[model samples]
Target chain A: MDDKIKMKVQELLQSGKIKGFLGLRERHGQVGPYLFTDGDDLEGLVVGDRFKPGDSRYPLNKQLMKITRGDPSGCYGVLVRGCDERGLKTLFGSGQIKSEQVVPVGIACPQDLADACECLKPYPDERVAGEAAEPRSFATVAKVEAMELDERFRLWLAEFSKCIKCYGCRNICPMCYCSECTLENKDFGDIGSLPAENPVFHLTRAIHMAGRCIDCGLCNEVCPADIPLRTLYKKIADIVEEEFHCRPGYGSPETPPGLNIRGEELKH
Target chain B: MEYRTVLTTCTYCGCGCGLYLEVMDGRLVGTIPCKTNPVNEGKLCVKGWNVHEFVQSPKRLTRPLLRKNRELTPVSWDEALDFTAARLREIKEAHGSDSIAFLASAKVTNEENYLIQKFARAAVGTNNVDHCARL
Candidate 1:
């Protein structure tokens, strides 16, 4: 599978189809994000599956934004898993990146990762490598949903109290692209204090992820406090789906119902 | 048009978390935790996330300062060192060596910290030495 990917990337770069290919590279037994240009060292190119489950995964879309912002006119190719493809769709719909400016080389995730993430779609829209695994159901979300109102509140308080205000969950999220985050505002969330006034800090971020989170589970993986952030955001996703009939990153990047509100006073 | 990431260790505390400093056109832009690092596993604290800011901050002191007439004034290396030595000697003579205390920073090397403790115990004949990590 890696050989096939390397061949395709080499063809793209040699044929001038893309200025660069953003993918993972393995060197000295360490895997990291690398931009392969001119295909001089295609031997190092590999799909991002070297780590075990629950290990931290790099936000490839976040890196894509950096490359695109620097060179908007330049066309680039990026390796995408199912979650990455959805993130790209979100980015495209929000006008963060032009669809024509990027070419995604889709790769399907294995069953282990698919089950670990409890993803509904384990394969990208376009697949060039690996077979699509069976979609898994959200057991964690179900467990949280079964709790009573007060129990849920108490559980969340206990979980959030362990927070160190590190912002790892927010910083690792690819869809959180706001230059001025509301969490940083003194009025919304307290500053220079640990725990950040429980529920306020976590709830504010969870509300923001209502229509944006793609269920990659990266936030939960990157969190140092081992908070069940994925389950919290999954509940928000469910609410958006049930209330507004909007499934984020399901199809094209149409505006989610939360952002599509048309106030009568502002209607032209 | 040039961009790259250099792997380095965080200097905020004793944990020594690993991170990659993103550089573009020779300017430090951002920091990302090293995923392969055994210590952090791609998780960074608030201090590590803002490491790039302090590197080129305008508020950071660029030169040594000495107090002149109750006001801090920029001074040469020789003047600053001479002033520090003179003050330490006068304090040790008047109140005793125990009156002065030495504080070491985590940012310095282990050898440097060892030298600082040595200076406090052997040279000054006092054990009033500590490190910022303790605080």
Candidate 2:
């Protein structure tokens, strides 16, 4: 454990700012989400390398929301990286989590991890662990974007065609916090297709990410087919930005901007 | 400790739909649909749902590159632009106006698309401007 991180955790626990901490713990060589009741166990607060829990992969803003619901006055703290912070913001803006009831403990990830995940910003706004790095570029995404439409579509189809319908992309997305997903809907996506609808199912998810996908790249990581799902979503984000000039979390919270609007919302 | 949702629009396509972007710690993370919006009615197509992934994508192109001896090498925007203009002129002079066709992208703004078509018709002396969406 880094001394600074340990000290911060100690201070947070001792100050009674947080009832507990939820983070990864190495269990039988596999990382799992664990809850910490006190700062006394800083010894076990090791930042396990090569250990990523399913919880970390999923947008858990909803779970955190549940934690703060019953107790209106209590404040809770949780670990967050750029993706996690983005998830929190989207959830907060979406009415799923209470911002005031939670405190964020930021962690900066390394470039290798960022590259492997195709991550853009690997650091949070604030950090209690590790140093932050400049945001990386999505070369893979640009490569796909540079391709002609038919080439791009063909590439995507080839990738999407390999899908086993594992729902791992949705399962690993921290933003996919819904108890009932439309992708899982029998009528919308159907069932027992094994591979599911080629473009429809994936496109459904891509549309669902408009103004909300934090570019975490977890969907790509979780996809069994190694579908470059991030590229499609990235392109969609580019389209949204160019068309509407609205960035999801970069604007005023009072205004609901981006692709989530209709009717008079259309400037055209 | 404050988290909430504000209804918004999907900017990915011509069909504008309503959805909610989740924000926490002043950062974007995920999306949800606006149940009250008329377009989506809490339903989003694939593009609208994944609209947030590109803002901080690792693959975004911040610098222009040009092919040099069959290898893409990073170059200044000016150099790339000049090269492109010179090549286009050479091609037009050698093979006539119809030798080249301009393909526009749906990702560009309306103004940019208009400018592209204008440039194609007047400068390139061709009316063969097409869009990616047409495909």
Candidate 3:
């Protein structure tokens, strides 16, 4: 499977189809994002096995943003898993990156990884590695959804109290590419204060992620404070789905329902 | 075209979280937490997230500065070190050694911190030493 990916990347680079290939490289017992240019060695290329269930996956789309930002005209190839493809699609819909600038080499997640993420689609649009695994539901989300309003409020307050305001959730999110974030606004949350004002910080971020978050679970993984941020964002996704009849990154490239506020009254 | 991530330890605190400094064309661009590292496990604090900012910050002091005529003026390392040593000795002699306090920083290594406390206790004959994290 990896051989096919390497060959594809090499072909893309050799044939001048792509200026670079953004993927992972394992060297000296370490794996990190590596950009393989036309003449660079592809021997070290490998899909990172750092995927742990319920842990944050590397934001490959974020890395792609960096590459494409500087050279918008340059074509680049990127390794993408299910969540990564979703992130890329969302970025495309938002016009952050042109579709022509990217060529995704998709890889499906294994069953265990899929179960860990509780993902609905464990396979990308195009697959090069692994098998399509069954999608699972978020048990925690179900539990939260069962709770009463007061109970949910209390639960979220307790969870938000543990927040150290590290902004890992925002920083790790591939879709969160705004230069100026509302979370930093003094009106929303106090700056330089730990546990930034309970539900305000968390809820504000949740609102921001309503149509943007792709449920990659990177935020939950990167949180030094064990906050169930993924579940909260998942709930937001559900809300968006129910209200707008739109699911982020699931359909063709289009602006998210939250961002596509046309001057029209709702039919309902 | 010349882009790479260099793995290194975060210098902000004693936790020594592992991170990769993203370099583009020999200039520091950003930081990504080292996922495989046992210490941090891809987690970083706010300070660690902004580690790249201070590297190129205009406010960052590039050279030793000495307060001359009530204004900070850039000076040679030798002059700064000599001045610091002389001032420390003079203050220790004038006021009791205990009056002078030494503060260590987490940005430095354990050995360097140890040397600082040792210098305070032995050279100045004072136990008035503390760490910045404690404050």
- For all the models shown, what interface RMSD does each have? 1.6, 12.9, 1.9
TM-score for the B chain of model 2: 0.80
Supply candidate 2's per-residue lDDT for A106: 81
Over A1-268, each residue of candidate 3 has an lDDT whose tens digit, in order, gives 6788898898889999998898887765667778889646799887876555323347889888877876767889999988888888888887777789999998888888888788978789897777788899878799998999999999999999998888889988898888778888877656987758878888888988877888888898899999999999988988889998877788777776456722122111
Q: Tell me, by lDDT, which candidate is best.
A: 3
RMSD per candidate (Å) reads 3.6, 22.7, 4.2
Whole-model Cα lDDT of every candidate shown, in order: 0.82, 0.66, 0.83
Using lDDT as the yardstick, the better of models 1 and 3 is 3
The digit string of per-residue lDDT tens for model 1 on A50-96 reads: 66642536787887787787776888999988888988888777777
CAPRI classification of candidate 2: incorrect
Off by over 4 Å in 2: A51-62, A69-73, A250-268, B1-135
Q: List candidate 1 segments past 4 Å from native.
A: A27-29, A51-56, A256-268
User: What lDDT tens digits, residue by residue, belong to model 2 across residues A1-268?
Assistant: 2466667777888999887665544443333344456776566554434433222343345446545653466677777777777777666676556677778888787666676656667777779887665676767778887889999889878888887776656755666656578887878966656667988888998987777777776666545466788888877777777888865554443335545532121111
lDDT of 3: 0.83
> TM-scores of the models, in the given order?
0.92, 0.59, 0.92
lDDT string, candidate 2, B1-135, tens digits: 334333456766656666556554455555654433445433454556666667567887779999899998999989999999999999999999999999887676789889999999999999999987677
**Full ranking by DockQ:** 3, 1, 2
Better of 2 and 3 by DockQ: 3
lDDT of model 2 at residue B132? 74
User: lDDT, candidate 1, residue A23?
Assistant: 84
